[model samples]
Target: MTARKIIHIDMDAFYASVEQRDNPQLWGKPVIVAWRGNRSVVCAASYEARKFGVRSAMPAVRAGHLCPNAIFLPPDFPRYRAVSRQVREIFQHDTDLIEPLSLDEAYLDVTENKTGLPTATQVARTIREQIRS
Candidate 1:
């Protein structure tokens, strides 16, 4: 019998992270991905925005009220999806036993990995390094 090694990886604030990475102007600021309409809600909030109590599914208006300095941008599904695919590719370098839970999250079975990492934690470390570069 063999023990199973499972690893869960989540891209923090996926949309906002990609937005910040692409737009230098958004760096080091509160960023919220949401439509600019009265009825719109927040799709994702960067860590800076989260510090101000902003979060996913919250009313955009309220988010603005909570963080007046937050830069609000509409959700970019195509870009986000592309980034998700890239992340998946990174995961694939280590293991094929991946179950995607969301655009930003997945579960990986790393008992046996293509990368030959000693453990799931090492596999995760390599994946994170790849994603950052």
Candidate 2:
């Protein structure tokens, strides 16, 4: 296989996941990361909220209307950045060719991974497991 080995890691609804991770009460519930205002747009929405049509970049007012029960919270960039850095560090263990798309997503070129993983899938899975731990 001559194709380059690349892995795209995206933390689904990272802001919402962080909220859920930090606050047990938010787990298994609709979480919307946005301010409470018509001008505000949703930064991220949990799967629970997505089921109700909530999404990133959607108007907060619409998000509220779509998921009235959703827990709306303001964006916390500093906290998310810290978490992102930790995630990036995990990627560093495998490869240094990381192209960060956002706080939660990155493109990793693991063609010649430092960890000696035979396949990109294994590298991705290992990074995921590290994040979980």
lDDT of every model, 2 decimals: 0.94, 0.95
Query: lDDT of candidate 1 vs native?
Result: 0.94
Off by over 4 Å in 1: none
Instruction: Find the candidate with the highest lDDT and give its number.
Output: 2
Candidate 2 collision pairs: none
Task: Provide the TM-score for each candidate, comma-separated.
Answer: 0.96, 0.95
Q: Count the backbone clashes (under 3 Å) in each candidate.
A: 0, 0
Residue 53 shift from truth in candidate 1, angstroms: 0.9
Candidate 2, residue 41: the lDDT equals 96
Residue 93 CA displacement from its true place in model 2, Å: 0.9
Tens digits of lDDT, candidate 2, 1-133: 7788999999999989999999998889999999999799999999999999898999999999999999999999999999999999999999999999999999999999999989999999999999988
Residue-level lDDT of model 1, residues 40-106, one tens digit each, is 9999999999999999999999999999999999999999999999999988998899999999999
Tally clashing residue pairs in candidate 2.
Answer: 0
Each prediction's RMSD over C-alphas, in Å, is 0.9, 1.3
The best candidate by TM-score is: 1
